[model samples]
Target: MLFISAITFGADYDSIGDSTIVRKRSDLTQKLYDTLLSIKGNGIFFGMQHATGYGVGWQNNNDSCDIEKVTGDYPAFAGWGASVTDCNIAQGEGFEDARYKIKLFHDMGGFNTMEWHADNPFGGNCYWERRHDKTKDVVASILPGGEKHQEFLTQLDNIASFFNSLIDDDGKKIPIIFRPWHEHTGAWFWWGKGNCSKEDYISLWQFTVNYLSDEKGVDNLLYAYSPAKNDSREEYLYGYPGDEYIDVLGQDNYYDLRQDATNMPRFVKMLETLVSIANEKNKPAALTETGAFTIDAKATMPEDNWFTEKLLKLIMYNDKTRQISYAMVWRNGSTSHFHVPYPGHPAVPDFIDFYNHPYTIFMSDMEKYRTKNE
Candidate 1:
């Protein structure tokens, strides 16, 4: 219910695109989209997954973030995992922890995005558990008439309850970018390409959106569809639900972007195609999840300035790719599996340069840009 007068839109319509499904979005959700649209081509907001929830040597500390320690400014965007709420076995904290962190980040003038690595509905350990029984299609089993349809609904009910709990001090719902079933192009999760048929994937996406928006009445959200690296745009859109059910166009590329300098062109071209699709659809695009898996001195790489020389160069490679609204790195879980630079890591100097770059927007930069645009 927190409406920004400067970015007001018709209450009954979506201003970003011709998506009727987004017509009933909350005021703050619409305003957030408008803000993203306003600053799309100007600068790319830097983001870190699980920024405030935990870090290299700390966990559950409200006042700690690896990015903040290194750059003196929080990321413009914060990525969170909703898998804990859905599966209770994935990479995020509990519901109350997520609610508190999300509200705190929003109150500090930062954007929030969440992804759900939902557990396999048909009996599995976690989202990564693939079934050996090729006779049954997991996605098919969870569709409208499938055997596990009700179980899927129960999981969605948990998700809706968690999203509904994201309230601010004024008791208004805090809008968030909900990204479920992400990285589907990869074959790691149950919803991956090889595990589910294209029709089933699309159906699952549409069903989730309809259930959350229409049945569950969860309207304070902007849905994002992100797939892992793809060979072509056709491959990327192979399982796309539709324009009406999607608000953001995002792609996750860690293999191409984090590799040597030779692969930088491929990453840039991939982003160009993604941005073109977003432009054609009139929606904001983002590098939803990326980053080197481990950025230590012993890690393999071309140069020491991974943040500036590699990541930043690829992002600034072409005008099309540069139009990305934001680029979010993966989480900083521990010393070996972290993404952002810690206090005395060798990547700190280049990270500072990356943070100081004109095209990179942090929290303070976003606030200033929004104020000026308003």
Candidate 2:
């Protein structure tokens, strides 16, 4: 009952009333969804954002430092950003390029999660440049009857088209955890706290889900809402849209590499809050994004086993927090913005141990678990 039987089409989702049709939401997606709902408090999956799509050694090339490329086993989930989906491109890397990556990642036996960095439709302003004074006005414009509503609709059309294009060799649309307007609690993006009112933000989120799922008939998506950092329950769900619109509740945090002591305790307490919320709502929770950025690769990389020593221990140490379905690290754009270490990097040994640990579930492990569950 947690999932529904779905059919996918290579052409368009809404125009699939005739002719041969492939299951758009494959049985594999159902298995993954069912497994996520059932694995609470028992185990957790390891994931990486843009792992194979790009990395330190390679940028959209054959030599990326992806989980499988480095360790020969893919991660449980692969994260991607939908920045360029607005400019008629699927994402930053380009339409065809991103399509190839998504297809390959899903075919390699990994789940997909995508986030968006939507440009300001009102003034055509970018995410980095903000005008808090115009935040409310911008929010109003995106509403159903707002002046800029048509532009917003155009953006969603392109995004829905791209998501529908993520087909496997069998021509099945890959299921995705579509996380739009993420990190809204942070004040960096146009849709952040200061940019829009809580009510308006919630409206935007609900509208997005409705337009995509109902209007466009994009049925292969599970909506996820992720906020940046918050200490208490109220702070975390300050602008929460509602339980109906959200399938997964997630959070993103970054461990400071400069500090000698790790923030595992704080993270544990926060996880406790997340677990409580998820249990109450009867939905899965995930550490959607976490990492140590701007590492001084030359300075011996402090606390080499940060993956096993800190991140993993956070979930293992607490009983309730272990309910998290997955924990994903950020991308390794370059030497400076890297999260996971490479083959020759100092943290490889520790990461290998983390990957081998029984509690950790990589892509292969997920397949094995799915088989057992089935």
TM-score of each: 0.88, 0.84
Taking all chains together, the TM-score of candidate 1 against the true structure is 0.88
| lDDT (tens digit, per residue) of candidate 2 on 130-241 | 5534544676688899987887888788888887677778766778888888888888777788777899998998788778876887867878888987888998997888
Residue 144 in model 1: shift from native, Å? 1.3
Model 2 lDDT, residue 186, Cα: 85
Top TM-score model = 1
Q: Relative to the true structure, how large is the alpha-carbon lDDT of every model?
A: 0.78, 0.73
Model 2 whole-model lDDT (C-alpha atoms): 0.73
Runs of candidate 2 exceeding 4 Å displacement? 1-29, 62-64, 85-93, 122-136, 255-258, 261-263, 294-301, 372-374
What tens-digit string does per-residue lDDT give for candidate 1 at 122-193? 556335455556576888988999998888888788788878777778677888998988889888888888
lDDT of the structure predicted as candidate 1: 0.78
